[model samples]
Target: MNSYFVTATGTDIGKTFCTAGLLRANPTLSAIKPLLSGYEEEQAESSDSGQLLAAMGREATGANISAITPWRYKAPLSPDMAAAREGQSIDYAALLGFCRAELAKGPTLIEGAGGAAVPLTPTKLTVDWIADLGLPVLLVTGSYLGGISHCITTAEFLLRRHISIHAVLLNESPQAPVPEAQTQATLERYLPCRIFPVRRDAGAEDFRTLAL
Candidate 1:
């Protein structure tokens, strides 16, 4: 089955937004955000899990979000810290097991909690978990100030670890410091991977080639 772990250079860099676009582009693939921090029950319809469910042609209801995401923390912090604030801790093994089970079922898009290096457990980095999963990555970055450096640095780190990068998606950010074309060109020069820009309202056809 074709699967990928979607991550980003940092928080609010449009990982969910990009993932939703990819889902809209490819409806057959199932999407899940197994671990989520800063989640409030009242905002279920606007949360990352909710957005993912929407992209999959499902309604963004409490049950739907919870079904896809088992671990939800209220604190808007890293998973480890967020879980701690509520007197809870993430079972890294269980989390891995859940993802493995999902992958075994079929093609799945597993979205990470934060940036590539964010700590899921106090001892495990997000990238480390990605490596453990052994799936290619769909990295989402933005065209904002310092974005060029952030994207290149992230790609370099992943490559050094021998992680296969399916693609680098350059999503537009508000008040971008540099044009999207320049950033994409610069990244293409340094990384041996496919680079594409995604619009805020991108359709399935827009991501048709990369969804494969």
Candidate 2:
């Protein structure tokens, strides 16, 4: 099974959006946001798990969402802090095991909770979890002001840790402060990997050729 971890420069910068696009382009690939914070049961239809379920051609039911994202917290904080608020803690070993098991099923795309540096557990960053899993990453960032620096810094950090980067996807944002071409060119100059620009209104065909 082909699997890749999808992370972003920052939260709400289109990680889920880009993942959904990829799922639409390649329906055979299964996607999951293993751990999600700020998850409201009443708003399941619009949550990250809900969106991913819809992209995979499944109904965003409560049971389905729970199956995909087992560790969910109501607080809209980082996973660690969110879990702490509920007097709980993430079992890193178990979480890693779950991810490994899921990847064994088939082509899977595991979406991280936030930026690559976000804390998964007290001692583990999101990138650290990806490194432990030994899966290549698809770094998703926005085409906004300072985006180039954010993308490069995150990529460099991963490269320093010997994490294989599958690609850098620059998802165009509405009212983007910087032009998409400029952001793409800057990233291309510094990174050794391919960089893809996903338009603000990208369609399935737009992502059809992506080698995720």
Candidate 3:
């Protein structure tokens, strides 16, 4: 059962891109993002759920998206706030149950929302869910300025909680201040795990190494 919880230094840092690449590079693998924010059901094909579905060679249907992401919100905010907009909240127990059921299917990558510390609920956090699941984290980060700080900070936070990190991926942003290789080199000194570089125009072949 090769499973990993795909998390990132922060939101829009390419967690979906990296995760989708891995899934595409490895057809046998499966992925699920149980909680979603800023979701527009009508435009499912361009959404994160759609991308992941496409990567897995599946249809981006409403039922398909609903199967992977039971909780979807329209507001582009943290789960706590997004759900609040709908007069609802995260049911941690149900979320845990959904993850557990999905993980049981094997070779799954659970992608978390926002950052590792994003609040899922008032008392429950994204990291708390990762810790509870006891899965190795595949951290995704960007190569922009201050990326090193963001990556290291998140890694340390995971380390402090004794959460094992499978690998750190540096997603190269367009016109990044620093080269992604340099960021990977810098992160190697701090993160006690392998670091993979994701180019801006990289395809599935570029991620084959990490796919297996």
- Predicted structure 2, TM vs. truth: 0.98
Cα lDDT listed for each candidate: 0.89, 0.92, 0.92
Name the weakest run of 10 consecutive residues (lDDT summed) in model 2. 203-212
Model 3 bad stretches (over 4 Å) = none
lDDT of 3 by residue, 55-139 (tens): 9999999999999999999999999999999999999999999999998888899999999999998898999999999999999
Return whichever of 1 and 3 wins on lDDT: 3
Tens digit per residue, CA lDDT, model 1, 163-184: 9999999998888877788889
lDDT of 1 at 22: 78
lDDT of 1 at 182: 86
Report how far off residue 16 is in candidate 2 (Å).
0.5
In order of appearance, the predictions have TM-scores of 0.96, 0.98, 0.98
Query: Which pairs of residues clash in candidate 3, taking residues 3 or more apart in a chain or in different chains?
Result: none
Worst 10 residues of 1 by lDDT: 203-212
